[model samples]
Target chain A: MTASRFSPRRLAATFSLGLALASGAAFAANEQYFPLQSYRVGPYAAGGTGFFGGFIDYMQLINARDGGVNGVKLTWSECETEYVVEKGVECYERLKKGLNGAPAAATNPLSVGIAYATLERSTADKIPLITINHGRTDSTDGSVFPYVFPLQLNPYSEVSAIVNYIGQKAGGLDKLKGKKIVTLYHGSPYGKETIPILDILAKKYGFSVTHIEVPHPGTEQQSQWLNIRRIKPEWVILRGWGVMNPVALKTAAKTGFPADRVIGNIWSNSEDDAAPAGDAAKGFISITTHPAGTDFPVLKDIDKQVVKAGKGNLQDPKRFGNVYYNLGVVNGILNVEAVRIAQAKFGKRPLSGEEVRWGFEHLNIDNKRLQELGAVGLVQNLKLSCADHEGGGAVRFQQWDGARWKVISDWVQADRALLRPIIEKSAAAYAKEKGITPRNCAKEG
Target chain B: MDFFLEVLIGGLLAGVMYSMVAIGFVLIFKASGVFNFAQGSMVLFAALTFVSLLERGFAFWSAFAATLASMLVLAWAIERGVLRHLVNRPPITLFMATLGVSFIIEGLAQLLWGAQVHGLELGIKDEPLEFGGVLLSSFDLFAAGTAAALVLALSLLFSRTRIGLSLRAVADDPLAALSVGIRLQRIWGVVWAVAGFVSLVAGLLWGARLGVQFSLSLVVLKALPVLIIGGFSSIGGAIVGGLIVGASEKLAEVYVGPLIGDGLENWFPYVLALLFLLVRPAGLFGERAIERV
Candidate 1:
């Protein structure tokens, strides 16, 4: 036994194992891990792949150019959710623990259903769960949703921004008086989330609005379009998703409604939604937090550094600067900036999930920072706090011209003053229901 | 009255599309008692293959031929790799197997062609065509014509061919047909290939309408009520059942839906299907099952 222990092979193997363990520890100490609950195959896979691909590509760019943010390397692993809520929860449970003893930076599920399902679990785990442009409207109050970030815009803000844009087009809010509008929405909680907000806005602006629902998956919408023809509203707000968007545009055409009069919401604004409708989708406009196209300096850098080097995550190069991909890149920028902000407060090593949550709450990316990041006009200026999770209540409008989207408006800010009170009321109600004592952001400041 | 007629006509035209999908199910069910749950995946697979090819610069006819070949190959693989192994399995077992196959095919379709939405152009503009004060979609009219031609061809194949006779015999009783020297495997293979062809047609039309994406497979949900109302075993039943489901659901969504909160088209067909099941489980044109219990 003694002679065996002293063997040359055994000694070499032990030495190698020790060296590997030491390096692994060193690697873990200097890394910020992001647990990506990504979907690459499902009904929503097109959106998922583009978004996650953009996100991963942005992170890859960071690693390639900056060698990590402040000497802390960015690392991530994806757990495919297929856009299913249960699968998302499973992914959350599987990946809440960071890799190789590194603390997880955050979780970006990208699905509203998954985000809602894991809200409590994410809070309990003390990890930040980022829902870029969609989530519960009440979750905007970071006091109650400390671990959840609705990022740039929440549901209420999205509708408000659209209404504001509509107002801007109508000459003024007062001019919208007596004007009739119809909202064709998907039949889900997400689609219904803005109903009250729209109603409030309608009443406030002296406009009459009609709401029509399209069932889930929304394939056949002839009846709804026929009804829209009957109503003859001046504008049709298409609050749709997946196959519903193109179907709405096509049906609107069949029903003799001008495509230019249809205003798609954030989810309905993608090239995937417009291109399918062909000529019917011409001149169709939608709201966006970020514009599509690789003309932005950030996108050009990504194409040059990440994609050209074969380190890009997009399976199809055609989707490199599409709407969803741009949203993902914007999302990646926000997440990384949050980590950088947190590192400034706490030391520059791999921080825990709670520390990262604080970073997200304090995320402030103004026009100066956007310019510095070479993401001007690509991402809206955002400033988050414990009282407000959705910092950027603004959107730009774009129109589809048969082949691609052309930005048609500058950043149109939502009436956040009008929306803030409503957001607080809902958040307060939620806090009372959950028996949660709201955080004192004043003291945190 | 004109508005009502418009809704009714639009719905009936839409029903033709549902009938197109149901025809694929009817083909498989009539020949082999298996429900072939992978039919939707086949549609997605075919459309994805065709559009991906088109994007890669394949001509229209060339892409169509290649997609048809792929579907036929898929039919052969399903018969050999799946249905062949479970020749005499229970209907439930076959259904479960096909359900598993559906997931595999969906994954494989996305894996083979990257998960990206591609707009399919069939060259038929979806512009409105007015007829007697009622506006109808020209594209929908083209779809209706295609459906009519497909149904007629399928009807002829089943009624006026020796292979059709063998298929009918096998459908009636596999053991008896096998004893009489009707190659059951060959009939199953032929029926599946024909179903595959139907899926290609359905896929092209649907892909053109909805864009070729993962959601293309979700049209299966729309066919469920049609199948239930028409009975899974009859192609003609599928057409009649589709018309009933389509027109009634649209009319309901427009007229009755407002009274009971709208968006009833999705589930109203299921209600009608349930009523049909209660009254006539064999469907309008389906043969009555004479099982000796």
Candidate 2:
């Protein structure tokens, strides 16, 4: 009787309208998704902003310049992690859940600590974790970490590249015999990762390695340098971040350590990091995945299309072709290409998380394509597969010339013959702990 | 031996800084019988103001003068606005009020200067002065000299001046002093103003050394051990306590920190202070008092 009293026609009309809206929202949600777990505040905010700016600018460029990838309309949302692991995890959960109309297709946790934490979860979610150049070295095992893709060189590869450069500079690998290499590292997971690789290399090359761990966000290290002075290490590999890099350089300069002998990791090498040390860091060689400077065509395009068009996220465009920004651009291009690759398989349309994962797993970028994309100066040929997430372990040595970084070495790939077994063993052990079987690459095909 | 000597000197220099801030705490506590937890925040605020003003194109001396003037105003406002209302409140209430004041000052400092560490160069050379294989930084020397002069001056003021006599009278017995025509409120205000001045000096020195940052409040924790070690009521004790804590921590970091891991320098001072507190509850120079029920 109550239902009869209520206008049945009006109720039906209202219900239909609601259903239509909900379905429309659901359809929009299935379209595309991009989740950005960013660190816009904290100790590393300077580096974070540059990279995040590049990422956002590229995404905007995609929307404005290309009218979305294959007309599916690219959608993205950012959650700030503040460079804290717990907050990063929270951002991952929040961003992955998505809004009413958009769901997260891929996650780019722009922090090493965050990447380490999310590596396991990304595997479970099957959501591709595009760790550009910083994350767990073991995640390079694509068979174990099916969804975790460290696009370029990890710490292991970078250190290998640095040591390789050092070897070359010293005339040959035989010259490293009986040499003392000190690793003055920022005492964190990020800094600690380099030690094992260095240690392994030390054992193999018959070199003595002394690891001096500097505390997080290091501001004081006089005693560490003093010890280094007493020991008189032949070379110092600085695996520091934030203020630690410059402080180390300054201390090394004071202690009369040859600036040329101090080699910094990718994270430790930046114009901001180098500028503070000034002449002290003049000859400080740093291993880089991408060359630093704004002379690249890709950066010019970013300046013209993104910045000039009022879509630029960078406050200062001079920081456009810096280390982290270039890394971000490379990451952006990789992400776009993955989507394009996925589209090739599925259809000429917006790809879902699963489709994107497939795209990332099978991405193949040759030298010509890289050059065509204006990413030639930044990165070389990268090909990802189901069994190898890192694609290759290639990096170049760049020396800081007081004001700018100049490339001193050509592209060098890590000896895969040495790394493959290590990666496999680590990945297998990890998979066993998690009760996961390595995904069969042949079966996937 | 040389390394130990260097560390000891560094520690002592650092300790002087702790003492300067602790002295402010001691002065406020001695006068009001309430612990001023806001002393470190005051130091940070003063440093921030000085640096900010300097950064905004104000000449160094002008900025310094403006900072002192601002601190004087802050001290006056705190005495009139907060302390005046809480004069009759319990010691715990006053303590809590100071903590609240600390948070407010922090928020205001952030609002005024933003949450970025500003390099505060006081134009004092920081290069080490070498002497017979012993090296000591110029800033450390300046700090030690300034702290010694300040302490000596404060001791003279308390011993010889009429206002100091009134302050001591107020500290000894507020009710009796008021009956004897000593304005307790005015004396308290002057003491607070002096404490504020001490905070400003400490802030400028400390800020110049470490770069002005929001974590500047942690420096207050460095003073707490000093307060506990030196007897909260004794100005001389504050300086002594600071020296002990600072020297011990620096030495511990060099000799003991590496044994545990890095970053022990930050926590060693607190641990040492805790140990001292366990042994000396009333602190080294605290006056023995008998309560009349």
Candidate 3:
């Protein structure tokens, strides 16, 4: 087999075969293609595997069990980013549409930096970018961020809930006066997103706030935890990512800061983070919008249809009902529900990017609706609208018991009324800087 | 004063941990003239293999033995497949080859052991021991003990063993050692095996602290500066260099970091190593490569 044997004729024939196979797999009438930006390889891969795995498992189960979103099968493909912003955008440009030339129904940039990077492009592409538990805090303002949806909770609302929960823990908001609060944050845009909101709440409630930054891939946090020791703050708000969360718990224990006194943001709430830290993470508190555990009615179906059928992507079945996994399931449900709602108006055919965008804006997953979907206690009632992309979701605090996470607090709404001016202010600043014309939803609706 | 002592003590403990990995690099570089940039990836692979075996119902001791056996095989394979071919190559070429090896090993480790994070408990209680009002991590003290024992064993091996003498000769002059009829390839194999053993120790310690995952390999980046400050081919220098980098970075972060919005621990080590290079051109222990032109 010399070079003379590999003729152009043979090359053309092979090329034609590949093209024919690719074209044959083109757009179907009742199938909605989704492009999921996943980071299965990276420093944060521990969280990525469980979250993306669970999300993918849920989406696959829906196709296998219920056949899809109202007879329209969901199709999706993943591009690895390793959580790098540039790679995320590269993935977006490559996967913005499928082989059919039709744009994807929605894009989920799970990383905050990716969400921010994709915000402008998604709007220009007329595709909905869902940043479920992350993204810019101001993206909560639907008027400014029309194409972007931070569905469950934006950073602002999420941190506000943490502050409100802290108030509850102290007996009352009035008692929060003169209390010392510490914000141990990952030194990134995602971690810093909660700082301004904390400052706002701290001032309004008369609590003093001190925020310490933890550098990325934060496998060590001795200095910051020791600072917490010196400051002796009553509460520590841990806005961490990946390994930082567990290190924070361990350092806190070593510093004699009670794990119960430290509250983590949603990103730090995963079993991946706590499980590694072992007993040091016991009594560690974090916020959540979705319920954790395998006892959920939806997971039962997922187990039978997805896991039993060998369709689930989980490496270990033990991770089936963990925090990040459940969050992935919730994220999958949210995307599916939006598609189902879009199908209501856009006919029984495949939904377009615009129709799905409309669906995300008008989604109403109330408790009763959740009950009907077999997600009874798994989801809280969410009502996203033209002006509120975040749906004003409530957050519950969960504490890590030795082996598992258990809910420790009732659902609490963020001090949203106090946060309204701040949200609008930041959104207005973002609009001005980006020269984005804020949509008049009152007129458009 | 207690606060200062605590910070100082914490930094030294961390330095000891970093040296555990740095020594792995020194062993190979000293004997084979290869930087072995894959040292971190090797650590990660060793830990991942050991823990993954434990997850599969192997007892801890059996899993550990299997991991060591795997490392032994790995060292032989590297010598036979890669290093044997690249013998006497330019230093940069050998270095680049090891980088490629690192990528391959990282991918293989993740593939063979699964990409999920696994908790590796050495059953060493992590509670900090208190003395007068200062706290010291017991696990770190245990790590220091491990480091000390390994140092003693390595000292004895280098001073008394026949193979160790041949390795020193090879390091002194490869051509001369070849003229003297020493099997240069076999020494390279032995050097890589020793590196592999040191890597396993470093991996288990770090994996116990940070858990066994793909990111465990990134510790190599940290070990590079330790090698620079300590000398590329001196095991004793690696220990001292790790301590200096570790303690100074911690103290800098605590005392000077907050003044500059903090997070100096990330770059302080590199800057310190760079400054140290001004004083010790060949590192604190590295030999100067001189030509009698």
Candidate 4:
């Protein structure tokens, strides 16, 4: 039984069989993959858990009910990021390498800061960095960001939509002339992205803009509120998140500022944000990309097919209607749809990371398809091309009615013709700094 | 002038919270000559326990009682298990041990209750109490009142009761108290347990003001200035010191925070405390001791 006594031909055959077995296991591991970098432990866990749960639950529903995306079983693994950028990067590095030597098709970092930090690596890796609703607003220049895809409307477009709503409310765009608008923003990159757009708009509309910053992990904001009181702007757009949202609302109530005059970004518009301030946050307006409430057809389908079957992550199905929860579901749906599109090209089999990028780049969701999926309430017709990353800057306004948010404005598309040049210039400058080239989108067009 | 007055009131109110935490440090130091760094973590632990129980559908009173009972058990266990073993150890060893305890408590809290920030509704209204032209949150007023009452109760207990007398004897000299038939072990246990309850009350008030999170443990740093300004062993000093530090820091942030990048609130008090320490190490109300060799 010694190796020296054994025949060389037999040994070689045994080794080949072992190699074949290992390769078989590797192929088996590559069936379907999506990596989730989550933060279920940290200060932002309140928002994180809701979004992560929704993302996971929707994936689970798709896998269990539809038998995976186009017959390729959808599989995912979550790594805790703790809302820290370094930990998020670490998680990405660990998870991106994938199981059994198969690379992950896509990654949802969830945090805007983490997304921004990992944007470069995603492009280099040729894996789609799907920042569903947040990231560097300039990354919407798909030509420059080739692999980085902000699936939903970017912050700049969202701001434009908000301002458009404000203009409409003030009778017309001319009414904004000589009006003073203040932006009370959280002191971070997420908060800072809105400033340039607001400043540009202020100049164009003959209005004045005031920029006040509230530091991150914001618990104390008395002075910032005091300054806001002194300024007495006609409108205040809040870019604050977490505890900062309620604190701002409570402070505004104390200062006798009309709650209706105060507006929040989509991140700040949530049941968790409003519950803390209670009545003070009532009537507060916020820009929304999707309609709130779980009455949508997609949600009903999910409830019937997923939860009713006792296979959903939601402890309470009612939470599916929350601003963030709904946002998460929408994000999940987009990710799934992208995978389906990839399947159409790469066959009804599990697509690779590069193939998923193709799926994201060529997504086309018409109104008819949206209606069929019961997501008519969630989003408008969205189509992404090689040169255009944002798909389109379409959003609406919603107002809080003490307990819930109700849509108050129709879908308003941002002036993409005006924004394209700006996005390109900024994205090119970023590319220059990073020593990268814009992807050639002429062929795709 | 009105702004100055307003700032002062806010500072004093904030000071009451600092003192509440500082008093816990002062009590432990007085009884055992050790600074308990775990005081802040104890606050977080107690607050999280109370909030988690309440969220799980426990009655407010039941949760409160359960939290207090748990804290008492914790204090007794720590005293018997760790502190009692290290009674004759150096002050640095005790400090390091407390720091270790802080981490252990923090991890245990996260393990027991997931790391989501819980809203600690003290079942108290957060409305501002208007007085003429000035206004203050009712929560702040309650906090100030509760801290004062607790301090008074501790003072009365230390001065009026026989057990208090025995406790004071042990604090003055454990060896002498042992010779005089005072049950040194029991006295130490009672003091630690009482201090644990005080830490719980302090934690709840602070947590109520700023929703309960693991970061609530850092609130103990706010109490350090109090211990520095007031002597380490004096209870009244801890209260007054906390008030001075809290008020001064708030006022500084109002006047000077704009000049800086707005994080002065975190460090200004420590700077003032350090300056005061350099000027008067024994503190205002600290006992002036003379060593004869």
Candidate 5:
């Protein structure tokens, strides 16, 4: 029946339609989307599943427990990259427009190849590309890479921290003088990124260093290890990935090299890397931005709230607190915190990718904040600025005991004071090559 | 001199591992006249299945038997689904089919077992044993022994058995063999099944060396030069090719590598294979194909 606009029934219908429209707008405006370019079925799937699972689980925990951060719901959708660069770029191009009217907060691919491939695209989209714990060393200079955040650690800082750890182990920095060290690096851009920095460190410390390259998917490394044996280096810095780590340890054993002297880098620090080598990896040490284990209060909460509630993202519960999984949790914490910090500045709403970049730049998680977030030891004190994308360059050393990682040292800070000049120099070269004006950090708010 | 001996011995052992992978390719190529690029994927699938079973509390032999059975089924399926449809097709067609099969098997394996790196402990110690003045890997020695045993058994199977004669006949001329009532399907099925078993052996050895993961499929790259140098159709040739590739690449990396650049071991074998191709088009052991112009 046709009714008058002012009639009681007509008025009720109009009011209901208005409420529905308003609620829809609120739902759209009060959500943040994270485009996950994840690889859960590939050579690197062990890392992919653990990391993305942890990231998704942490986000789920936030949604279930906190009802979203400041009433802004966290949402994400995955595009399977299989850790391939082309697929990652395709995923970024596909998902960068955001989902369901909600703007994308960031894109985390968790791959060096993919991250580098999408660096320009993410910048063009004004979306923050978070490459936590691993990325190009030059990306540390945030002024040149405004939309890129190599959070926690960059490759240069990682190597610097490794050298610092070596120095510490050798009694002092001066004791490294005239000592021999070998760096057995994977054959890739990511693996070769630190060679120059290593040479510089060696010159500064007066240590004799040798660099050996192992080709990609490094399943065989007999020649390289034999070279190491011949060099008789005091320590071997293993910059390995995937199967290379296990093969290195096994070959090192065959060459009569003590496993305790082999220091694995960030990528090689996981249980996936060590367990395959069995007893050969017993005393192997590696540097990590975050330690693995379920002892953290945040992890306990996640286990109780998200996992027990049957909303967890992980397929296997055993990997809940593993290295890659914990890194994913730490990444989730950092991403959410950036959103919260941005919300504080830009009002409580779904902020744009540009706004998230500002939040990332101003991120400063001190000891108190770490404790408050129940991530005191899980995450080190981090402070990012307009000029620095890597908030924390510190790492903790851990040793494999044939089963799990045991934290062996407190947070060891990288030589950022020495690395900044090099980072700026490389960044300036990049800026010139790209014909882009670098951002002035001092002038930025 | 001692360092030279050590490097040479290490290279030889490493070559034996490559020989193990090449043997799979040799078996398939000899029987079906198709270069099974999927042999690498088969290795990955076999190892992943076995390790996955072990993780689920199956004993060694049980897991092994289950994996063997599954591989045989996979062989049967490949013969029925792919090879049967493409009878009398060009060699390139069969090669392309196996390439497609590789991707499917890789995806299916991961889909079924999940993509986690599993450590395989064969209870053989990998420590170095001092042989006179040179240090040698005990694990390498054990692997060499296994390779020797495998070669001996394979040689006997190809030369002595009725299936072996039928397989050789099929390889020479499938049409002729079919005309003689060789039951080409049965021969193909048997060869593929035996190739699957070879894949299982190679998978366990390579998996123990480089964790059971997706990269296990990439070990096929190492087999390529071996296949070229040893001739694709000869199991004995694969062994000889592997030894040459392994020893030469290692020795080159140690000696000639520093003179040029480092990390030549990956490509040095290719250089040797290219030279071999230039000098002998059919390879040292490969039979020269005489096609009527």
Candidate 6:
């Protein structure tokens, strides 16, 4: 046989050797490995880039400022999900493995559909999955979902807060008796989650609720908005995501609906969504659990340390002030706090997935904690015990004034008294479906 | 009466947008046997280039001219690099090659101008104009006029130009056209450039309608049903088919939808196109090609 420069066997051997060496380097590093399921390229990329950019920037900020949480470096590998569930699954499978034969410290699914798909797998793999904003609402019931953490606001709480804000807008809770409200939502589980609560509230408050579904990547909404125009709803709530939010806003504007009366859900209320609509988004109200803008001290630190030092992921550091970006920073802070809290118990040497779970279970972020972290008013006080994964979130209302979002309402708390039974009912249904026994909150640390 | 008129006008305008994209498909399919699946990706790429160039401080017209030049280069490269090698190959092979080209273009667009949704404001005001008590989107109306102008221009080119005759001859029979001194390569290059122009207009209209994002690539899928309703090889068919699909779906959704469920507009067009397919296999304007063994 003639000798060749790149024989198949030799090439295969070289590729294998390269992988071995690369994996060895990763294993040797004294760093905490975090696999980020980021969606930086899709219809949702505007939101994704802002949020994911903030996420990576804050992680970089942590590594640079604090010398890694408790002297251990934070190592992260991002896999793009593109807001598609199948790609999310592929990303999850690809990055589930960690350095030194460790279970992945944590994974952020970032999407509800992806979270739903990975629920069983993550439980089996024993990796603590963190979904700060959007995920399975029942996952907040830690008795059933041991691995998943719906940190900030579950859909139920979010919807109630939105409803409360609407009540506040309508003058009072009792004043909403005859209000005609419509919810233009993205047609997915994320969008569908808000419907049940709306239906329940409609009957209770005597408001005629009509929600319209916009299909995925909703660019076409002429007919839907025309219907909204005909319905003449007093208030139209937008439970949309990705490009759908702006499209809904624009279409609603085209249909002659006033911007202030049309409120967007937390997912729909961000700089990414409103900026696209431009003047059409002026006075558009939306619900948020946290404050927006880069006015926070921690964000300044990130800008000073990470961006100024040229270690930040954002191409434009000015995007650091966006609503989604601030949310991302909050997500990173909660994650790092969980690690720090976990370190106190697990001896601080690159925590296992299980140790991270314990830390998340015992998590508490009161105003005092937020101030200490330099994030004071950016986030509302939160506590996540073994029973409540959501930790009782409250949402504030903000309205876009053609430029920046101005806070319109105070932190209106969700009626946990109402949400608890609903949460337990669904969580019990989930437990029964999966043949899972409820974790004894008293029995575990 | 006003509601009906408004809905009808809206649908027709929406149809005009669909026809813009469908014309790109028909141009490629008529000139060459390949169904240009890359038309959507081309629109996305063109929009990304146009927006990014403008963002980089190029004047509006300068950005437009630069985008046009880049699209011409892309068309030429595609014809030279992909189509030239696949000459005389099965039409399916060429279609698949275009699909590959689309994937390549999508990746290239994302790589070059990072994946972020950009608002391509082409100075088209989106405010609804009240036309005799009926609400009409000025932007959509302008887009419809643009599509009409484009169709008229394409017709004039075909009926009044020697290059168009050569294209028709090449499309009719490559071998016979070659015998008559027509260059197959040149015809394909012009056809691709024409299709590229169609994509740019469609991109500007759509990028203005919805901000430019990866989702623009999927908007091309809507044209498939349009092509099915209209014939794949006829420009007139594209306009008529797009109008039919658009009008019927809107009318149906507004009147007959809520009884079943809301958002019937999503699948109504496909069902209408499929039903039309069953009645006329050759499509509304397609030539009936018969094979005898």
> Residue-wise lDDT of candidate 2 within A1-445, one digit each (tens)?
7876578887898899999998777656545678888875554566777787777777777777777778766777778886888999998888776555554668888788788788778767778888887787888887788888888877788888777777887888889999998998877778888777788999998889988877655655656776676678888999888767776876676545788988888787777567656456789888788787766777777777778887787666657777777777778888888888898899865556777889988888898888877777687788888888888688888888867889988897776667778878988999899898887887885
Task: Give a tens-digit lDDT track for model 6, residues A205-252.
Answer: 899999787777788888888888999998898998877887887887
Could you tell me which 10 consecutive residues in candidate 2 chain B have the lowest summed lDDT?
B114-123
Candidate ordering by TM-score (highest first): 5, 1, 3, 6, 4, 2
TM-score of each: 0.96, 0.82, 0.94, 0.87, 0.97, 0.94
* Model 3 stretches astray by more than 4 angstroms: A1-27, A100-103
Q: Model 3 Cα RMSD, Å?
A: 7.1
The docking category that best describes candidate 1 is medium
For candidate 1, lDDT tens digit of each residue in B110-144?
89998878888899999999999999999999999
Clashing pairs in 4: none
Task: Pick out the ten consecutive residues of candidate 5 chain A with the lowest summed lDDT.
Answer: A1-10
**Docking quality (DockQ) for each candidate:** 0.75, 0.18, 0.40, 0.26, 0.81, 0.39
Q: Could you give candidate 1's per-residue lDDT for residues A265-335 as a string of tens digits?
A: 99999999999888899999999998899989999999999999988898888888999999999999999
How many angstroms is residue B181 displaced in model 4 relative to the true structure, after the best TM-score fit? 6.0
- lDDT string for model 5 (B76-180, tens) is 999999999998899999999999999999999999998778899988999999979899988889999999999999889888999888988998988899899
lDDT of 4 by residue, B77-159 (tens): 88888888887889999999988987777778777876666666676676666676666767778888998899899999999
Candidate 2 residue-wise lDDT at A301? 77
Tell me which of candidates 1 and 3 scores higher on TM-score.
1
Angstrom error of the Cα, residue B229, model 5: value is: 0.7
Q: Candidate 2 chain A: minimum summed lDDT over ten consecutive residues — where?
A: A96-105
Root-mean-square deviation of Cα positions for candidate 4 versus the true structure, in angstroms:
4.5
Ranking by DockQ: 5, 1, 3, 6, 4, 2
